[model samples]
Target: MAGSKTATLYRMVMPDHLCPSGLKAKWLLEREGYTVEDHPLRTREETEAFKAKHEVSYTPQAWIGDKRIGGYTELRKHFGRKQLEKGETTYRPVIALFTMTLLMALAAAWVATGEPLTILSAEWFVSFSMCVLAFLKVRDVESFSTMFLNYDLLARRWVPYGYIYPFAEGLAGVLMTAKILPWISVPVALFIGTVGAVSVIKAVYIDKRAIKCACVGGDSNVPLGFVSLTENLFMIGMGLWMGFNAFA
Candidate 1:
């Protein structure tokens, strides 16, 4: 069946410009083990003529035998793929932010104590990551709150908790960063983290509901699973550590 499959890709590749979506369409067809008949619409006239001939409004048109597949997005759908035009979410944003926060913590630690990595660097990493996550939540609290309400037990019980959660996180992060008032910071982090972990567990494991996590706020695409659960667990650990160190 693979050997019998053939695809035709008509794309725009001009002297000064190449249509990215067009290039992507061609790659997709070739990657799928299809014999691709590549056609370049190099000029405005050629592109218009092709579009008119195929009754298409777009340049990146694909054809499998006699079937016309639309653009890059349409071709992905045709091939049974769930992805963004660029790509699907793989917790990349969360990973990038956390990695950068860790680096920042190391840099700050190096400046203060002449050491790049130390026990304190972990503390800084948690605090800085919390601040960044809080910012994502606060950016669109309405959206974040809406997504949170879907699975957060407390948010469902008390709608205002959704609105206040971001502020509470930011406050805890700020306090943690300054290493001041451990009493306030520890409890805040502990309370929120516990609730969040429980909510994620119940939603994802117990109820087996697939849902979007509001970890990075309302605009997030992060799924409720290992990564989200780990985030809450980290907070719980941080809160306990800070509390122990504060009195110890």
Candidate 2:
């Protein structure tokens, strides 16, 4: 057993670049009630020498007593946390976006209807989430379109559709939220949502192809699977409900 809670950290802190992993490692050590002895390699030569001596290729190495805890990732494993592997599929981005939009929708409902829980709240949640998702895609349309072409049948068939998708999604969402122009919004939402659902199902379930989702954004690590399906399903449900009310 270790005598005391002490950790030694070696990280890079160059004049031009401060390593993020190093800062994270230091923070993690402190959070775990360890007194950290931080060693900063301030130069490239120092970094190289340290790497050679330790026979390691990465920075932010930690040591607890005589046991080498490796890098920030290894430190996380030591603390019983799962570190995300490179290129690993994850639902974190979609989960975060939906969770945030849910809160925002509840807040909007409270302010507008004087009640947080209502049918309108659910509608606003889907509408607001769609708008936010569209914003992320349009933020870097080039990158989003490129990634979207990977699995989107419409985008693959007609490349221009990729560029128009974000704007169309945003317009439908805005109209739905304001409860106006159901004729326009309903059809638009239904079309895109149906297409997206089909594309995702074919790519993931039928083809069994591993891919990243462009639902949240281009740079997102969200896996192309259930969350994408859910997003499309929400839009479909909202469109159907709005259409029924508009025509009925």
Candidate 3:
């Protein structure tokens, strides 16, 4: 009797009644043979505690038997359904647009500073590189396999991290350009470096077989070996230098 089948599912969800995804998941589970019992939980602390006790996190988590499935998207996979895919056309066109916008913004800064093109600072270069990388990532996500892989560990982490990385880079760029908040830039830079470094380690050691970069919104190439390491080290060096000069 220790391994008898159970007909119930326990879901601890962020009680956002307006989320279409959450509603969709609830509907889907009910449609299946599941008796869904939902508990509303908010705040990171509560989420973490629940996860610690139940071994799950992220919104719309599903439990079948003792196994926990995190997020609405993952739940869909377990039930043999496809998750929503980002349209290729929708993402591809925006890449060019954002690239042009970033270039224009950088040009404006260059003109305002009256600094020669050759005199661009490390922060400016790093910021521009990140913007370019982000653009590329967006394009990469449009491919089919990138959008559909079920057990993408790197993608899981990278997608969330990607949301905040751009803002950090942009803020550092602004600080460097305006010649303000020098002290803060160092820590900011270091933070960026640390994230990149951690990302590489996760990709290589922890998620080696998990094919997909997940750095962009969609699935793309798995950045492995030297490629991941080099990218992180470059960022780390940029951050440390930015921090050092800010203090200097």
> Which has the greatest TM-score?
2
Q: lDDT score of model 3?
A: 0.55
lDDT (tens digit, per residue) of candidate 3 on 172-227: 65565555786765577677667666766765677774444433335444334344
- Error at 217, model 2, angstroms: 1.9
Residue 89 C-alpha lDDT in model 3: 25
Q: Which candidate is the best by lDDT?
A: 2
TM-score of each: 0.71, 0.87, 0.39
lDDT tens digits by residue: candidate 1, 1-248: 55568998888999988999988888888788898888898999999998898788887888898988888999999999976644234687789989999999999999988998898788999999989989999999999999999999999999999999999888998899899999999999999999999999999999999877888878777777888888788889989999999988
* Model 2 alpha-carbon drift over 4 Å, by segment: 1-3, 13-18, 42-45
lDDT of 2 by residue, 124-184 (tens): 9999999999999999999999999999999999999999999999999999999999999
Q: Give the TM-score of candidate 2.
A: 0.87
Ranking by TM-score: 2, 1, 3
Q: Clashing residue pairs, candidate 2? A: none
lDDT of 1 at 216: 87
Candidates by lDDT, descending order: 2, 1, 3
RMSD, every candidate, angstroms: 5.4, 2.5, 15.7
